[model samples]
Target: MTDYFWDFDGTLYDTYRGMVKSFVIACTESGFKVESDQVYKSMRRTSLHQTFAIFLKNVDFKKKQRIVTRYETVEKSEQTNDRPFKGAAEVCKWVIEQNGRNFLVTHRNKSALNMLKRDQFTSLFTGCVTSENNFPRKPNPASLNFLCDQYQVDKDNSFMVGDRALDIEAAHKAGIKGILFDPDDIIFVETVPDKRIKSLLKIIV
Candidate 1:
């Protein structure tokens, strides 16, 4: 009965394509000519902020604000991609069938809930920790800690599964093990996660 905390973006949902599109659009609107492939490549290894900082180095603070604002607005739009990754829903159902529990911890706000509802995945989770909850972002452990307390989940018997280093770091900060979902085997780090899985189905109980 391991309790689980899941990252919603690239781990569960295939949101990378949409993210890249939105980012490119935002930067373009802000007068920057951002290449899609370059953005995608940087996003694979870095956070959005770092990616922006690298490409938009010459952009003023006010212009950067406009770009970020535009990105957020576009990300929250209805056409944004919200499809779940292969076997993601099955993994959640597996947790439930094994008498374990699962919850979402994502930077997204209401958009996360909306996507879950749209995809009929809402009932799969015990609860969610989103930006709207006002918790600090990943690697801070505040939101993960809150969820652990709320669900009475034992840190030793819990896992946080996500696609990025921040997710693993956050789980570590919360005193729980982290599972890195690396479908592409892109992460060649010496060590970051307690476990690694190439596919969702590999996450056995």
Candidate 2:
């Protein structure tokens, strides 16, 4: 059986609305003046650094910090509205039924655990590696490597499933397969994945 590592936001959970709203609010409050569509597009298509670089161009460090702080406040206030996509919980449960392990590797903090528990998905994961764990961010593979080591997972029998290129790159860096969940086909990448699934249900053993 394979062990699956899933991304939280935009993969299993539909957090774009809350996240994009937070970005827009932060940018506006911090005097960044970014279009909401641009914020949404950049966030969905690129890394957070790239997103900020594009929208908050030539801005000072303090302004960036202000945007981050505002974004956090907005995100926390809207956290409860971030729900999982259809079939997310069911697919996780199915993995367990098939004797496969389900784990989470997300940039989110411990609050992700609260959302999972609220959705009755906390018990489905073997473990979760979040931002609070202090591992290097994705495309580096350190966190993924840590999770694999903790679970004694066989790299060949494991997959990283996410909605971003960093996710696939991290999997490749860790010598594991990757599955890109591109329901909207918004991601255009040169690195092909072992699997490209449009729905969580497509991730079958």
- Residue 23 of candidate 1: its Cα lDDT? 94
Model 2 residue runs over 4 Å out of place are none
**Superposition-based RMSD of candidate 1 using all C-alpha atoms, in angstroms:** 1.9
RMSD of each: 1.9, 1.4
Best by TM-score: 2
Global lDDT for candidate 2?
0.87
lDDT of 1 by residue, 1-205 (tens): 7888999878888888888889999988877888898897677666676888998888889888888899988877733456998898999998998898999998877788888999999999998988889888788999999988988998998999988888888899899999999888776543479989988888974
The CA lDDT at 57 in model 1 is 86
Give the per-residue lDDT of model 2 (tens digit) for 1-205: 8889999989989998898899888988766677777777787778666787887778888978888888889999898899998889888888898899999999889888899999889899998899899888888899999988888999999899999988998999999999999888888767788899889888863
lDDT value for model 1: 0.85
Over 4 Å off, model 1: 78-80, 188-191
- TM-score of candidate 1 versus the correct structure, residues matched by position: 0.91
TM-score of every prediction relative to native: 0.91, 0.95
Model 2 TM: 0.95
